[model samples]
Target: MSQAPASGSIPDSTALETGASEPGARRPYLTRTRMAAVLGALTLVLIVVCAAAVMFGSVPVDFTRAIADRTSPDHAILFAARMPRVLMGAVVGAILAAVGAALQALVRNPLAEGGTLGISSGAAFGAILAIVLTYRFGGGSAIVPAAGFAAALISTLAVYRLGQMHGRVEPFTLLLVGVIFNTFWSALILLINSLVNLYQTRSILFWLVGSLEAPTYGEVAAVSALGAAGFVWLGWHARDMNLLSLGDEPAHDLGVDVDGARRAIFIATSLMIGGAVSVSGMIGFVGLIVPHILRLAFGADHRLLLPASFLGGAAFLVAADLAARVAIAPAEIPVGVITALCGGPFFIYLLRREGHRGIAV
Candidate 1:
């Protein structure tokens, strides 16, 4: 006869297999010195990409002239058009990626993402609603973003509630509800578009597909502020996230407030996702791609993972946006198209790899 395990002692298989006491759990793979170097490299790459973006618009821009004279036409195009769009792309990408990393850690699901939670779909619906209302009945400038944020929060709360079973949120249930919500909201958006005029319909379609075109300074500033706050909050809770990843019971035993941490991170991610969707439209896969790649490169230590996701996400989206601009020369494809093209294949690959394990992290 085998003896029962002690009440508080973690079993070896349970602890090690579930990421509670894995190798390198005591210390992350990327040290501070290495992280700093990586960040510096990513930043340098971002700067170079931004410069290229500014220089390669539909109309030719002289970089030398733009730098020399801010008053010149080339400078006007660079500062007024390209700079804001590029900055918005970076901000949106960082927020999405960081939020993705946090959500994945929170639920212990590799496939968990903002879209998987219905936040993006809700946000898109809200944005579309705002556009329709603005066209039908004039509203203030803040209506679109405010509506989007509100809808996102509501949808996330609904998912949270629906995912709860006996006081615990189940990852698969949440994902299922999210899929339903996304389908519903997408149909609603299409229905609304059908009722609207041609111009409004075009606008809604463009936003739904996503774009980094003609972003204004005000929009960029708002997204940056919100994204910064979200990033800081997520980073501060990174260690807590690591604890939560080892299943809820183990996390509680480790002194982590599992519920509180999940709630806080959910809200933070919602803010970031809503802000990005409101500004940049419905760009997908940034969150999915960035976090997974970083996890494969560096171990799943949120302290390093979250920040690396931010930097890598910023660089990735900037590069994608650049491709969107130059791929068709005078005519530009939406950045969302490019991301989907990249993310779709990778997503399939992940599905196949995780299929046996049911895609749970």
Candidate 2:
């Protein structure tokens, strides 16, 4: 699952060239300045898509008036019903993309993501546990997310530890370990559901399917906070993630502290995944598919891959969520279901390509 480029592809140096006047001076097109322009274009596209998402829904509301009138019904619908969900999609999309970028580098596994490796499941278990505890303690919605965050962190740590074999962690081994952990956690969740009352079971089932059914303002704010933190933190590590594509030994020889970097990435990835799970509850494939698509579209440099995936991921989820809302008309579909339905085939396609021709890390 590692997003490393296939052997013999031109390096990112094409984005730059020697100055026209000098033999080796960098050229205008290949300059970092142009890369910034590309990123700006992506950002512009994402903004337009987000605006479209905010505008299209069951009851089409004029966004201009909605934003201006705090007391209008359209405002209520836009602010209370739609805004949070849109923001959640953006946050989750960015977090998932960033996590995918990091994990692919961390373990050199392209398929690595919060959902695939049981991190989301683990986080869900924690959140569920918190919910049960809150029910007993007479707590509120805030407690639920807090509990979920703890669970997500714990689950990711457990997976990381177990995935390590003889002081090394291979992508395939980590994938296997993640599957096992995912099964265990999923079963645990089911067991908890069984022991709980019927109401709780129904609630758990709904949450498990994943939804963008308009989060509370508090939830949206918290998700935004965590997501922003993770995004900022990971942006600093973009170069490290790029270097890591060469594999751990080579990365180490190049002065990258393999173990320390892995630890940081793991923690960062867990936090991002946990935050996303806490808010969105185990949406799958944004991570796996987003990075791959970016890889194909923009090449494998993490510098470009990371931001492109983020923008692409945000657009992808928002569009899918919009589809889920309109496709069923009055009855909204769980966003997770839609993403899986759409992304599953793409995932299979990726597998087909991998089987036919492998990328060397």
Candidate 3:
């Protein structure tokens, strides 16, 4: 691996690594030694954290016993509550982080995140609207998350369309548009909140702040399916993402259909973000923090960044969720708050050090 430039922006020297061609040999996707090592370690930690999350809770049942008595209340607690929550957190965190990485790269701004681009807020508005309507009329079953997904998709498209100027998108313009749209949606959400009753408002409040308050088995299954599909779609274009860092012209010259690829990726990522947010509220930090951390360690190559972010995000969220569980025990604080507590300050530090140049937000 080659060394990073003297600026010290990238944490590892791997960003300078280059490929050399050998006759009749397949090209390698990644060869960053440090990044591979970190990815392996993070994967191991994620596995342990997932297991711990499933086993640890208020009831505190042993995994062995829970496995033996799957039908009992304790086992039910493990299966119906903790396991689903942990699994869903893993999926959601991975998707958010991966999507964040893509958006940061696509927008060429370090400050850019899924929520910052207005997708999450749009999803929140949709979810709240669904809750409001369901409470009032009651009937359509799939309208809840479906509305959220639609809102997220529409918001992302709006951002993309509005940000485009002379056939290309400007990073600063995109950021400004996103900020404005997000504010508009937030105000609308407040109006809805004002109209709703206290109990419904309380539910919307927790959801807006972001919570993983044990989703239903059906929701878990739906989110899993969506995340898995999104991951595969992203993985297929991972190499193209690396080329995108060199700018649109070079990527297009390299035979990447820049617009088409971006379109596909944008849609898939919106689905991933919207579906996760719909199920678990607006858990922050995972998307905003995890991908940037992974980029620091793994360089800008999406081949490694994508998978590494998936594992690292999973580990980070599971750890945060564990802390949320243990911090208050019976009460159990929201996992999103815990993540923000840790990630928000780190984000500020990053901004202080690397604010002006090439920051995507």
Candidate 4:
């Protein structure tokens, strides 16, 4: 009855449907090929940065000799001090950044981070508690991390519960509740410090400010194992995260168990944060800054964003640690101080940007 459509022409019904969706559709800038290129580039940069971290510390050491000849004069410094610290930095940084990206998606809040959620404070409190107990009663170093992990999980779950209302989590409400919990834990840490001796107080202060000064090989291995496990788990759920970002109703309609996905992501992020804070103390901003930068460069696709964030974060902290080592030359600044210096301004910018949008989630 009707003439056939011309070759290369879409049918009228198809054309109409496509036009109807055009206004709401978003085109991604990073294609599969482009994402691969960017990831490869970031990985190369990470490798170069890791080498530099080992080579350029407070002391001058020949990079080639440090790697080639263990008998070289710098061998002890390279292996005993710098290598473990650098590896710790890499592990902690990657965990923070990857978890940050996942949490941001889960909460639908760009400002979400471990420190903001009180997870770091809770971990620090637990570690400090273990330190005090060990100092008085005597125990292995393992007690601190174990306590920290338990405390971090408890605090995160508490926050998660506080943030929910009528089975929904409002992003702004969650942020506010997290801030309150952080303040409460911070004050409690100070109170505990007051009760301890001078040496313990000093150690607690160092942990609070954060450092990568003296990580043992065993601590490095433990954190690496935990971090790798968390990364893989989060990566497996990356598709669900992408779907969740499209809004709850749409995600639910598409067969995502919204509440279950949220809970899983929350637990996964807490585990990553706990493992890191247990080892490195409260290193903030790496999580907040690394994920944000990568999201801008790539897109909000978690599959790519999560891995990219890990690599980028590893490189970033390694470089930051290197700067912390040499910036004072024989006296080191806390790595946290350097990250805060960078993150503080960025935080202000985020607030201002949100203000322009009327602070809507």
What candidate 3 gets wrong by more than 4 Å, as runs, is 1-29, 32-39, 62-72, 356-361
State the lDDT of candidate 1 residue by residue for 1-361, as single tens digits.
2434666674543444446665534233446866777667777877887777766876788889998998999989888988998898889988888988998888777777887667898988998898788867898878988888888888888887887788776877877887798888889999998898898887787767888888899999998999999899998899998988887888999998887887889778888888899888888888899999888877788888898899888888988998998888899999999998998898778777867667433
Residue range 33-135, candidate 4, lDDT tens digits? 7678879999999899999888788888776887798888688788989999999999999998998888888777888888877888888888888889999
Give model 4 RMSD, 1 decimal. Answer: 4.6
* TM per candidate: 0.87, 0.87, 0.86, 0.89
Ranked by TM-score from best down, the candidates are 4, 1, 2, 3
Of the pair 3 and 4, which is ahead by lDDT? 4
**How badly does each model clash, as a count of residue pairs?**
0, 14, 8, 0
Residue 102 in candidate 3 has what lDDT? 77
Best by TM-score: 4
Winner of 1 and 3 under lDDT: 1
Q: What is the lDDT of residue 251 in candidate 1?
A: 90
Q: Per-residue lDDT for 238-347 in model 2, tens only? A: 77887888877888888888778777777777877877887787788888988987776666778778777778788888888888888877778898999888778977
Q: lDDT tens digits, residues 212-234, model 3?
A: 88778888889889988988898
Measured by lDDT, the strongest candidate is 4
Ranking by lDDT: 4, 1, 3, 2
lDDT of 1: 0.83
RMSD of every prediction: 5.9, 6.2, 6.4, 4.6
